[model samples]
Target chain A: MSAVAAALPLADDALVLSHRLAEWLGHAPELEEELALANISLDLLGQARACYALLGDEDALAYRREEREFRNLQLVEQPNGDFAHTITRQLFFSVWQELLFGRVTGTGPPAAVAAKAVKETAYHRDHAEQWTLRLGDGTEESHRRTQRAVDALWRYTGELFQPLEGLDIAMEPLRRDWRARIGDILARATLTMPEGPDADAWSAGAGRQGVHTESFGRMLAEMQHLHRSHPGAVW
Target chain B: MISLAELGVLRDVRLLDGGRTAEVELTPTYTGCPALEAMAEDIRRALHTADPRLARVSVRTVLSPPWSTDDITEEGRRKLAAAGIAPPRRPGPARGPVPVALAIRCPRCGSTDTELISRFSSTACKALRRCRTCREPFDHVKEV
Candidate 1:
């Protein structure tokens, strides 16, 4: 796999998730939370831009890409359900991201990117972990909602460990560490670990193959609207 | 506009071609910092204002050796505190004449009894905190 091929998966993941979080700007639970979500969104968007810069023509790659062309994990493409659901999704993805960035080897562009990203991902993971503790151990309503979010999003977690084509990463060890860390967090939060197969004949997968879930199309439509409407528009 | 140099993102400046052109290197405090573009533009405008004869001014973003809150200058920390914002505690040893503070002190009351309200705040570079003694909330430039 070429450099572009390796970088695309990471870039697309950041871009899609950034857009999802950006959707929460005016809709978050409170003002501080809104700012937090937006800042995280900006951070992801910046990471995506940095990766896309290595690929050539960041705008064309991002705004012109079709649903079937994006290499992001399906977990990121799922619609944000609620504050509880959003936090759970963040918890799942940020943990995976921190591990992936830390383990990616070599001094290539990807490694350089990962080196910088590992620190940011640590903070993102902490934000999610703190919220997980709050929602899982809070009142009856929060606990129920967070547990529901966890169960709903469990199957989507499997695709994260699937190795990208050019990136030299060992999938099994990454998966093991992910499971151990996630299990510890859930246990402390007083939430039960979901028992479904992370990857199997039943789990959702194939996002790496350019396939995506239903809600992704709507997201792409919104993301591409401004660029498509004016081919050469710039400010 | 005011704190760019104090923030320490400005890494270097060079004048070339008999001073007709200027090149500026900047290291971002965070990979996703939105202020980079504005800072670049500000530098260009400021350069032209200072030297109308300068034909070109280029600002480049450098990502390697990623920035830390420790890079914030001593003057920057003082300005932040004066503005009711807490400066970041250095994650490493003091390397300069000024000593680093070990506590995340309340900029309002100079009390060390502040609790983090959120790990993030109005910007990506800051964390929100509330002082237990003064009962006032403020932004703290979080250590990276």
Candidate 2:
């Protein structure tokens, strides 16, 4: 596979997650929350845009491609279940992003860019952890719902750790180092790190290999609607 | 006939073709007031009468420097007072090179009897505050 194909899935994952986050805009129960969530979503979108821009032109890499041709995981594309679900859902992703961004800060980008993003993602992880604790330990109803969210999302968590083509080659040792750090954080949060049924001792999966979920077609549809509808149109 | 500073612009502000309206993107004094839309509309109407090309004004939400209480401009402070928020007392600047905690004053009943209700109140940017003596609820822009 080409190096671009190998690098595609992680950027794709970031893009899809950015979309789910964008859905929360203007709809948060409180106005402060609306603004805050918007900020977080915009940041993620910015990161995803950067990742895709590296692969190709920002607009084309994001919008010009067909659906099945893209390769984001299903976990990010999953619906936002509820408030507790959203927080719990982020627990699964933020833990991963925190490690990913932190390690990148140590190595990638120019010193200035990497330094700024590391601080920013740290705050994102902080917010997620705060809400996770709140919903996890609040009232009985809150606790139960939050747990259920984790349980439902757990099955899909397996794919996050699945190795992409050349990730081991391209990502340096950050992935290995990240697994250890993530384990400690999750354990501290009193959340068990469950694995897929085929966990351990297995070769990684193929998101970067251009494999994707059925729903990605629809998501790509909505995301690229304007671009596809008005071919060669400038905004 | 406005200075670039009055336009709240800094250096070579591009006037794009699809300019939506003539509006100042004043940073909010606090977050999550239900009145901001009304306030933006009022600014829009004011601008519209002055220049028909200024069809509508909108608030541009910016979070850099994180919208601190310190950002409330002198003119903005006056507007807030006219709008009925008793401004917090600005402490003397780092006297002897040490920062002192500033105090918030109650706009209603001009008393120093004020306390924070919740740090995360009506909005993330504002804290819910109550005047102890008068028991009036007021929003405090956070010291970001």
Candidate 3:
């Protein structure tokens, strides 16, 4: 597969999720949490920019693309429901990214990007894991909300293991490691592990094919509006 | 606030095309560091100010040999502490997500009873920390 084809999925994932996290800029529960979310968002945005730069003009790729052209995971496109939901989303996605980047090897932009990103994703996963533990084991309401969020987002987790077109990753081992890590974190947090996507026949796996959920369109509309309106505006 | 040189982000500088063109290389502290662009621009301006003969100054970002806190020079660490920001301890080796949990010293009172307030701070490279003895909140350059 072409390098652009391979990098597109990873880039799109970062871009979409970065935008989602940035939405919490002024709305986060606390000042420190806002800063943390923005920092993570910036990191993911940087990763996306690096990957996209390798293919073509990064702005054009990010802002000019239609909903059908994006190759990001459907899970990332899901709305940040609440603090717990966002943490659940981060936990699911960060574990997959950390595992995937850790296993990525070879000489290229992807490898170089992965080498640095693996470290960043490790922190992201830890942040998510910490919040998961607090929410899962804290007050009774917190536990209920945390479990509800996890259950709601569980199906989307399966799509993460779905292999991209050009990336040379062992899907089985990646899937296994992801499952084991998620299971362990949930067990520690006093939360029940949700059923695997394999158990349910209709797991999400279509984002790589350029198909996205309904909310993704709205997100893209907001994200692309400024660039779409102005042909070549720059800061 | 330490200079990139002290932080060890600036890698190399070379004059190509018989000194008419200058090429500079830099590695970022993090993959998505926003300061990189500003740093590059600063280099370009500094080069022009120092010597107007150079017709071109190009800044390239290199990712190979990923940067770590160990790259920070002793001078850098000293400056960091002097500026009231705790410098990271020597991160022994690259390991898994389980941090070694080294006791961080407070830059203010020189106390080892500092606690992490947040894993992240104003920038991606720093973490928010507070000291028990001094009771002063400060930023700690994370050991990555």
- Provide the clashing-pair count of each candidate structure: 0, 0, 0
- Cα-lDDT of candidate 3: 0.90
Clashing pairs in 3: none
**Residues A45-70, model 3: lDDT tens digits:** 98998899889999889999899999
lDDT score for residue B40 of model 2: 59
State the iRMSD of every prediction, in order shown: 1.0, 7.7, 0.7
DockQ of each: 0.63, 0.06, 0.81
Please write out the lDDT profile of model 2 over residues A21-69, one tens digit for every residue: 7688767767655655655665566556545654678778888887656
Rank order by DockQ, top first? Answer: 3, 1, 2
The true-versus-predicted C-alpha distance at residue B18 of model 1, in Å, is 2.9
Best by the TM-score measure: 3
- lDDT tens per residue, model 1, A13-112: 9999999999997799989899889888988998898889889999999999899999999899989999999999999999999999888777777777
Give per-residue CA lDDT, model 1, range B22-94, as digits (tens). Answer: 9999888777988899989999999999999999999988777677787888999899889988988867664
Residue A82 lDDT in model 1?
91
Q: Is the docking of candidate 1 incorrect, acceptable, medium or high quality?
A: medium
